[model samples]
Target: MNPERTSAGPILITGASGQLGAALVKGAQAAGLAHRAVQRPAFDFDNPASIAQICAETSPSLIINAAAWTAVDAAETNQDAAWRANRDGPATLAAYAAEQHIPLIHISTDYVFDGSKGAPYIESDQVAPLGVYGASKEAGERAVLSTGAASMVLRTAWVFSAGRANFARTMIEAGRKRPELRVVADQRGTPTAAPDLAAAILRIVALIQRTGWQPHYGGIFHATNQGATTWHGFATEIFAQAARHGETAPTIVPITTQDWPTPVRRPADSRLDGQKLAAVFGITLPDWRDATRRVIADMLTQPASAP
Candidate 1:
């Protein structure tokens, strides 16, 4: 996509109902990127043919794939369905973009890593996914890269958006209903705000176009809010922040990952080192807590106050 032609042609955004997708639409408008967003039945993952058709019809210079099968546990038994959406959907989109030679900005998850490393995972680190969701996302990343679609795969973690059914929303609901809440403390990672991440996505496309970057130039990059925190610690911050906003907050009881005994195994340390995104895209992300504060402020004004 040419940065010069940005003002006229609308940007086609998929998964408009999701957190990241919604943020992209808002960000695009604010940045004067694009207004056209494709959602279910049109851009839905269940129908890959329809998805391809939408890309062809819109012919957007830039295509952002913000949709994915994000149900971590459900993916354990539903690997095929997950692959259909996560892997196959992007593969199809990538192939089309390659035929049209357009640029794509696809959002991915930090779950793609197994989290065995002691430090933050850099883009060059070896990937060893521990579960179905992670495996699917890893596969999708490969497909996007292999398709030669001039795509940038941004892997993020612990996403919490004010308008989505994410951690922050659940915390508010549970904190209000229960006097105390139990949370897992073993997993550690950054909490990325949808809007901040969305801004980074736009910057990636802009940087690539301005530099005459090629398809080989496209690779995996981590674009998450800085710093890391366990789910328990994250919940604590959310509750504390809510209290500051005059909302009732509950005590978060920290527990081990095993204590909570979930069906799916979560990465123990999903923190990603975003040096590559910073160096290549020329963008610096805010701290995770600061991003959370912005989300909480926006949540306070939400009429439905829901995800």
Candidate 2:
């Protein structure tokens, strides 16, 4: 089917309850785009049968797969669940997309890389996932790309939004409760705003609708905000901005990654380059700091006193 108009058919957005999915639904609604956002019992990666059920019900002209098992540390123990969500489910979706001749946009992660590159990662860079979550997502990327469907794997990093349980929210909540907070300083990656990523996805949908799906449009694309920062830096900025709105600014202590150990080793530097996204789709996300400022403002509805 030809992508003549974005509104010509319903756009299917999975993971509707998630941060990015919520943002995509809001963006689509604000843009007046016909779309159906779904999650959980209605459309779950854990329940593979739901995939075809929802697809048939929505009859989506374009599909955006945002549903996935995103708990990083938990994935270590839940390997089967992670693979089912990240790899098998997406593979099934890709196969269906290929069969239906539908265009698909699959959301991916920066974790696919081991983060040893020291510099930013481009779309073509070699993938060496350090954990189960990353490896499963990497497998999903391979599945999507191999399907030969008009699919675009948009890999993003450190996604956060005002409406979800993300780093920013965790920092803000921790900052209010604690007099001092210790944050990981060694790990580096861009903090992509869910709203910004969602808008970018919509722009891609619009572009495809306007120009129709081209042969070159079906591949991986890196889509993160323009800059990078460590978790410590990000937490500091969050408090700095929140302080302006009368929220307490806690003392942030920068600690090494080892100080804050986890079940899996996180990427020391997982920054993704957006040059290809700009060159191809003429799309780019806003700066991390600026996006942080906006999210902080949105999150600080009523400033809470320090504990």
Candidate 3:
């Protein structure tokens, strides 16, 4: 499986406008790593030509594909757009990466699994996406892995950050206006902090940079903060942390999945086992609780932004 690798160049990050993408950009800048981040107009999945143009312009040594159509419910109605962003866009990047012998790191979602599995899922588990969004992402994973490029598909879940619209921010903002909020408790997954995931991605980049591309590094890896909780539990924690900054805590009524139905069917339990990531990359994200605390602090300390 050993293949000749291209010389190192600036890391190219797609979906720069996203929470994870923005965090990656910030992390790269803080670490002083050479990186180029791009979003829509300049680089977009809807515009296939833009992918190649951005790649050519960046001449990236390694690519961290943080781009994807993440709207779970919207995917049901907008299947084509979801496919373009999730599957087609990544396929294009993978093909180009293969042609140039560039290593790629593609971000994926935990939704690939149907959450039928009672326990945490390992990388080798068969994927059974429950909805359009998950199905599109599963297709993207196949495209990236099948290209024969030095690629790693990192499957993460419940990603949030202060930089964008996310669960934590939504909870805080909504709690301020409402006295009580009903959060779905039946669904279970780890809440991954964007900055933590970003830091871990950079660590992988460093490892690849230090040791050169390793064949074993090119595969599926589950990456999430340690521990799992329901959306209800997550909101409770978010409020607990937010309250430290004098924000009011609303009464959170735990509700079932049926109580808060959406267009897409989310996994009942999608906790990803990250032992593979720890063993392979020697990286583990901080616990969700700690990550939540840090993000809440960052959110409060920073200027207010639209959710």
Q: Give TM per candidate.
A: 0.94, 0.96, 0.98
lDDT of 2 by residue, 1-307 (tens): 5542334579999999999999999999999998999999899888878998998888788899999999999999999999999999999898888887788899999999999999999999999999999999999999998997889999999999887799999998887789999999999999999999999999999888777888778899999998999999999999999988888899999999999989999999999999999999888889999999998888776345232
- Encode model 1's per-residue lDDT on 176-243: one tens digit a residue: 78899999988999999999998887776666546654544478888899999999889988877777
Each prediction's RMSD over C-alphas, in Å, is 2.5, 2.1, 1.4
Mind sharing the TM-score for model 2? 0.96
By how many angstroms RMSD does model 3 differ from the true structure?
1.4
How high a TM-score does candidate 3 get?
0.98
What local lDDT score does residue 80 receive in model 3, on the 0 to 100 scale?
99
Q: What does the lDDT come to for candidate 2?
A: 0.90
Which is better, 2 or 3, measured by TM-score? 3
TM-score of 1: 0.94
Better of 1 and 2 by TM-score: 2
Residue pairs with backbone atoms closer than 3 Å in model 1 (clashes)? 164-307
Q: CA lDDT of 241 in candidate 3?
A: 92
Q: Can you write out model 3's per-residue Cα lDDT over 135-202, one digit (the tens) per residue? A: 99999999999999999999999999986898998898899899999999999999999999999999
